[model samples]
Target: MLKREEVESLVEKPAPQFVRDVLEHPPFRVTPNTTLETLVSYLRKFPVDVVPVFKSVFSDEIAGVVYPHTGLLIKSKKLDVKIRDFINSPIIVKESWKIDNVLEILASEAKWGAVVIDEEGKYVGVVTLRGLLSALLLREPKAKSVAAVYTPVEEKKSRVGYVKAIERLSKIFKKLAGGEVEGYVVLNREGGVAGLLTVWDLIKSRRWFKGGGEPRPIFGRGAARGEGRAVGVARVWRLMFRGVAVASPDTPVDEVARYMATTGLYLVPVVDKEGKAIGAVTAWDVIYAYLYGPKEGREDVEVKRAVEIPVAKPQVEEAIRLRPSRHVTGLRARDVMLTDIPAVNMRDTLSRIRKVFLRTGSNILAVVDDEGRVVGFVTRRDYVTYIAEKSLGYWKRQKGKWLILREQAMPGEQAKVLVEEGTAADVMKSEYPTASPDTTVEEIAYKMLAAGTDYVVIVDEKNAPIGVVTKDELLKAFKERGRSVKVGELMTPADIASAELFSSLFSVIRKINAYELDGVVVKEGGDIRGIVTVDDLSLRPVEESLRGERLVFFTKSGVLRRVRAGLSRLRYSKAGALMALDVMRPFDHATNPDADAREVVDRLLEQGVLPVVGDDGRLIGVLNKMDVVKELARVYITYAMPERLKEAERVEVKSK
Candidate 1:
């Protein structure tokens, strides 16, 4: 329960002229006359998510918005010929316009955010749906309403050693108990929000499982005294380390929050598990989800204000209801995970390790073993501290392999100088944290902060690493993979969770965002069912269709890349055909199964004038790029898009 004034204080008011205006110059503005290739490069270099495409002559007037997706499309085709080719007409509004007016336009457009224009009709800034909602939450409410709270749960927390668990749990209780939540539910093996126990529940309950258990050290010291058996499982695992509540990749945050209110739980785990921990959802996550669009309510209806009286009413008469249809949009792991995340082998050389450390803009690298499981991590400071402590001679004299130069290496010496075992099994941080494929961006961020690790390992059910995540990867995942794909493909889907939608989404997103992937596929019964990208189910509203479109483009690009590769392979094979063909077929010349048709053909053609040398050789089918391309063209034209014009005569045009 929050006071109205308290909520109001958090809401951001309309941007004012006094607001540290970036009016110095509106960053970079592109015109329709700009070449598409140049535009693509421009956008890539610019930090702005969008570049305003203004019409020529007017210069100040915005004609359309050019975003990365559209730019990528043009660039992929080598058709980034001109900006006018891809400009999209966008509805523009002024900065002075009330937030309510902006909301009306957004609802109608079915868009997540809007572009802001200045009085001169020049593009100035953009307003997001969430930014506006945050502002609204600050306004006076009709009444005080009870809502749920959300928190992230680490799917596979570094086996929090017993001692650390106790310490961390103690600190958690001290920090979380007195704050916002009424009572938190402890999730159990069933993946159900079990036991609505609160601080008050602990205080008032008279029964103790262990004989005469004391108040403060609920499970820490008690287990030690009680025959070495773990005691107070609830307090130790559930109470201290919160279990992320479950959510589906498609579950609406409003619905989750409403469910939380009914259950009196703060978080919902978005799991792909049948029944287990995966990812998490929170009250605030839902709030932000709704803040972006109509999925929360009927977003298009306009509000009419009482100008004569001091009344602030929404322009639209849409009702806000917590229902199943209120799906979460603009949220996915792709929106947040970092892209081109750094990774390393467990047995990488110290020199290489040092290079990666210095070269990477990020602070850490995901250290994976031969099997690709994350084993350990190395940080810049870790290396820096080692260098400060160790002598140069100590690293130079005592090593066998060039990869290993050490006078005498101490165990785990200066985290950075240590040799990677190279095997996926060795040197990687096995005792590390993880997030499910469907974990929300916010949840992953919290886990990364709490765990104090930049890289998270994405693992499958058997604990095999699928991908690696860093803070930067998480951001990229949120931006790209957030819309369509699930955690399974995006993450290393594991039998980590029982087959359940909620568990699947939670676990997948957590893993994807934690490890920073496009998104993860949700697994159920040890198979992929759905995909959760950082972008698909998170704060950014990049669409799933956009992802598919991108994949199609990439697939097309891959086809081209693959074809070029095949051609290169063909060229190599062409030169050594005779000798290699003889090696492949040691037995019969006429019966040989491995040979080049072109070489054989040339031999036959030349043999008409000169006697054929009886070399032991075999002949395979002859095909070349020109022949293949010709066939492709014929087939493609035969089945291609229907033409309105009359069919032309079928003629074969021989190539020179």
Candidate 2:
């Protein structure tokens, strides 16, 4: 409806902000020759919501822009395809075109977003529907709040002139007395919005940068480099075709650990309705979550649980039950352990204890005196060193015979022969990192990282070992905590059938993810055996497609395909039945696809069954089995959850 002259005036009045003005251009533009793996790095570095794909026709002019979201060339599993193959016509708009016209065109097409040549048919700045909408409806807090505007690294402040945009936002907020704009998002030289400098963002940034504390060189440098490369890479991997696995707060403790070991993901973002990211569960957090998490219903939790144990000394079945009694205890040291016991003495000759160690193969040998208290703990590494030092003749002479001696060994000789050695008094590190039984799994993890140890002996108020914490035990705890709870009570006979251990890891993971339950129970012949946690499932590796990692799958009316990484906002189907909104929910703020395939695995671990939705809101691929596991390792630790969840329900809830 606008005339050319008017449009020209509009474009010219604003003046064409060169690519340098708005584009972030730090790592520079990627060419068609770039590989997809490298391309993925580019996207991650820029942090640009999307990256710009380009084909060079000449030295200066761009042939077209590749919509990284929709472009398959960037995601081709082949990794050898020329990036130019994915090029689409650039959605160009002249700086002179009225913003209103640009809006109108975007609205009409609904499909197209990028605008290329302007009314004068000359190269102009690019514009997207969401960005323009954000610009036009600047006053709508909800809209702006929901629709965060981000630019690919190749198109950030360095490429285009967004100084004007920042100025505008600044002025509006200034006029409103610091109340108009929530905060201004600034793109770094590479084009991605480097960080949300919201008032909150500003506070956090200042605290981090200006705190005048000892600095971690690696963290600081990597963070800066990451921001610079964010923009270019942002748009490049727009599709984020992969899926996520998730679980609920109430999932069992053991199952979460299993998922982590199996899936190998560091964290899983927790979400709620509206698909907003709420909180996150990391591998370490899983252990603490289970130990410190509320256990009103989990009173019977344990590892290597004793089955059919005679409560009152019934007729012994083969003298004794070989099964180690499983005991679910609190998070701290001494809460779930046996304390008083005779222990190996470091002063004794290695040969004397070798027989005992050979018999038990217990990794930890607590060195104590006649008082029956722990002095030092020698682990398997120590014994390995002792064996390695022995002459081959000694082993050959001994053969299967056991040797026992208590001869004195020099301190220096012992130290040289032990992998890690100390006297009963010196070698015993804090047998138990002091903590209450009520401590949560989240809290225990921080303590472990700080203490630089994997094993934490649980203790009572009296500082005795009620339980022992080890890497394997924590792994189980992490797996269990990641599994959310089911609508019904667990531990009941009827509920035992719904446990995950009875089903394939994939199916249980899906149930944990779909139903948002804790963990699935393992059942052997209708009896609860063990459970698979989110971490266990997440750590399990699976086969993948060529493009990138596949998060989940979809099958409706006989179609099955994997989810891609960059195309998080899209759903692919040969049937052509999926809608844009379905894809958008996972990426864009409007739809809020809170849980991805990774998160779904967490859900399945908790619940016995998972719920899925596809076209017409029908169930699609259950996201069970090896499919979701394919992309498990790709998940990172610190990525923020979706922004649309209630505070009390997310991972942050524990922090708060």
Tens digits of per-residue lDDT for model 2, 84-150: 5555555555655655565455434432245344456654445543233223221212111000111
Candidate 2 runs further than 4 Å off: 1-60, 66-89, 94-101, 107-112, 115-125, 129-656
| Tens digit per residue, CA lDDT, model 1, 1-656 | 88999998698654322111211222466788887556544533332324567677466666777644444333122333677877766756677776666656655554434567677766666654334433444343221211122233442322111112222233334323333232343455555333233332332221112223233343576555653222233343433222122343433344444343222233444433243334454434444344443333322322211111121222111101111121122433444444344678876755566456434534556676688655666644334323323322112111111223222221112112323212322223446667565554444444444454445555556765555555544333333333332211121113221122333222332333232233233333343333333222221111112111121112211332111111111111100001111111011112122333223322222111111111332112111111111221222223321221223322222321
Q: How far off is residue 493 in model 1, in Å?
A: 36
Residues forming the 10-long window of minimal summed lDDT in candidate 1: 574-583
Residue 3 CA displacement from its true place in model 1, Å = 29
Report how far residue 108 has shifted in candidate 2, in Å: 3.6
